[model samples]
Target: MARAPTTADAFNAVAEPRRRDILNYLALAERSVSEIVDALEMEQPSVSKHLRVLKDVGLVDARREGRQMLYRVNALAIRPLWEWTTTFERLWRHQLVKVKENAEKKTNL
Candidate 1:
């Protein structure tokens, strides 16, 4: 049997839609806080707040670039989510196959 996937604080960070959107945006490339705020057309405080949560969960990494800090996706942090979700996908597919077979049998009867 496969071992359980590692669960990180990332789950909580992704609970909010805004945070998830931030992750998607970051996937393209690292950006400074100001850059994110500008692209999102949201207040600086709001952007910073989301970034704080993401930073706490290890889904993103930040470093000082000049006077500003830039953030980027930390792929390793979400590995567990990917593993568990893929497993769920497989389980759902199997269930659907069985349901279809049962329906076909009933129709044939």
Candidate 2:
């Protein structure tokens, strides 16, 4: 049996440039696995592997439509990423303020 991918695993998987491209495409609309493969010009198996991870992490949803399995972004999973990132936004702003102050001091010297 395979262990299910966690949220960290899902985010890490998409840290790959190509995998991020896949998510960007899915962001526009739901797609069949074939559509993703053709759009990315990548191997079907590789695309499938990424999709499996996405699904496991609740970042993507999959459903069988007749002979095809369709996939779409999971809004819930992406929501947490937004919530998590917002915390860092405040921290970065504070750091930037300090950096700007240091830069001004150096320029005066």
lDDT of each: 0.86, 0.82
The residue-by-residue lDDT of candidate 1 on 15-107, one tens digit each, is 788888888899999999998898888889999889888888788899998999999999898898898799789789999999999999999
- lDDT: worst 10-residue window of model 1: 1-10
Candidate 1: where are CA atoms >4 Å away?
Answer: 1-8, 98-109
Evaluated against the true structure, the overall lDDT of model 1 is 0.86
User: Which pairs in model 1 have colliding backbones?
Assistant: none
- Residue 90 displacement in candidate 2 (angstroms): 1.6
Q: Pick the candidate with the highest lDDT.
A: 1
Which lDDT tens digits does candidate 2 get at residues 13-107? 55668767778899999999999999989999999988887877777899999988999987777776678799899899999999999999999
Model 1, C-alpha of 106: deviation from truth (Å): 12
